[model samples]
Target: MEILKVKHLRKTYHTKKHEILAVEDFSFNLKQGEFVAIVGPSGCGKSTILSILCGLDKPSSGTIEINNNLKFGYMLQGDNLFEWRTIYKNCLIGLELENKLTKENLDYVNHLLDTYGLKDFKKAYPNNLSGGMRQRVSLIRTLATKPDILFLDEPFSALDYQTRLAVSDDVYKIIKKEKKSAIMVTHDLSEAISMADRVIVMSPRPSTIKNIYEIKLTGKSTPIQNRKAKEFADYYDKIWKDIDYHV
Candidate 1:
């Protein structure tokens, strides 16, 4: 079933100098349980699209029709965990914001930490954990809200190359295990291919969908494992070409 629908989405920024069009004629639909990645060049308004979808910004013209019953969770480029707060406390922030910090919700958050191997470090501060572990905590914090759809905006960009790879796998596993639908905005072609079921390629400047590829790898595997698939290189090359052509 269609969980989200965006039609003719357009965003314009008006400054004293002139009007700037960030997104134009953009439209897409997300299915339940699907992981979709949006990829484009640096100034392609990828992040703007995400902000509009998640209600951080409004579209100038067009419509976004989401399942009214669904909730949203956003994970940004940085982990954004509080330095002074313990991992457990950080994870509870979301639930607290939504006023859903009941016993049942707390139990679910604890279960997520335990299932993801962060149970032992619940009392530890974010600084005490490795980069990957901290990102896991950030993800867990988002999940604690029990959102129906997740919006990931370059969530691993701050990590080193190796840690980014490992953490992507960790995140992919958690999302799949929780059966959540996600839309990720990324610049890395390989990362997009590894983690997404479909990749939406956008054009530069006033961005719109240039191409969409349905990723079909050989096996059920983690993001890192998917990177090793035979079709991985092909998908990478194709996406690279598409972005390259647009730029």
Candidate 2:
């Protein structure tokens, strides 16, 4: 089912001297359980599109239609966990702020921590965890809200290359296992191809859709395994060329 639809989306910014257009003629649809990734050059407004979709900011033009009763979860660039709080408490913070710290919700959070290998460290602070473990905790925090559609903005950008690979695969599995639809914005073409069901390429600056590719791997599985697919490199090259990086 189509859970979200965006039509002719445009966003502009105002300054003392002039107006700047951040996005231009953007449109896309996100279906249930679909993993979509948006990639473009730096400052191409990829993150801007995410902010608009998640209602953090308003678009200057166009409309976004979402299925009724759908809630959103966001995982930003860094893990953004507090050093002072235990991992379990960090996960519950969202529910606490939303006034949803009920018994049922508490049980769900515990289940996520246990299921995702964080049960042993629930009482540990964020500073003691490895980078990958920290990212998992961050994901659990986002999932704690029980959101239907999750928006990820450069979610693995802060990690080192090896950790980035492992964490991305882990995250891909977590999102799929939870059966949540996701729209991720990243500059890494390989990451986008390996992690997404579909990859949308955007133009630089005043962003617009340049191309969208439906990824098909021979034995499509985890993001890491997907890297070895026969068609992966071809898709990467095509997307690399389609991106307007030089402009």
Candidate 3:
């Protein structure tokens, strides 16, 4: 079943000097439990599409239809964890805001932390945790809200090379295990191919769908493992050519 649909979406920014058209005539549909990645050049309005989808920004013109029963969780580039709040408290913040801090929900949160190997660091401060651990906490916090769809905006951009790889695998597993649908906006072609079931390629300024690639690899594997799949290089080269043509 389709969980989200965006049609003829457009966004233009009007400044005193000139008008900047970011995205134009963009449309796509996301199926339940599918992981989709949007990739484009730096100024191609990839992030703009994400913001509009999550209701952070309104499109200048278009239609966005979301399943009435679905809830959204957005994870920004940074973990954005509160320095003052303990790891446990940070995870609880979302539930608290949504008025879902009931015993059942708390138990669910605990289960996520335990399943993800963060149970031992619940009382630790954000600074005390490593970059990868902090990102896991951020994912846990997002999951705490029980969202049917997740929006990840360069989620692992802030992490170092090694940590990013590890965290990407960690995040991929968590989302799959939880059986949630996700739309991720990322610039890294390899990362996109590794984590997404399908990659939506966009054009340059005033972006639109250039092409969509269905990533099919044999066997079930984590994102990191996907990188080592036999088809990985082919997908990478194809996606690179698409983005390179736009550039």
Q: What residue pairs clash in candidate 1, if any at all? A: none
Q: Could you tell me every candidate's TM-score relative to the true structure? A: 0.97, 0.98, 0.97
Q: State model 2's lDDT.
A: 0.94
Residue-wise C-alpha lDDT for candidate 1, range 110-205, written one tens digit per residue: 999999999899999999999999999999999999999999999999999999999999999999989999999998899999999999999888
- Give lDDT for model 1: 0.93
Best by TM-score: 2
What lDDT tens digits, residue by residue, belong to model 2 across residues 143-231?
Answer: 99999999999999989999999999999999999999999999899999999999999988888899999999999999999999999
Q: Report per-prediction Cα RMSD to one decimal.
A: 1.4, 1.1, 1.3
lDDT of each: 0.93, 0.94, 0.93
> Model 2 shows how many backbone clashes?
0
Best by lDDT: 2
The better-scoring model by lDDT among 2 and 3 is 2
Model 3, 95-118: lDDT tens digits are: 998888899999998999888999
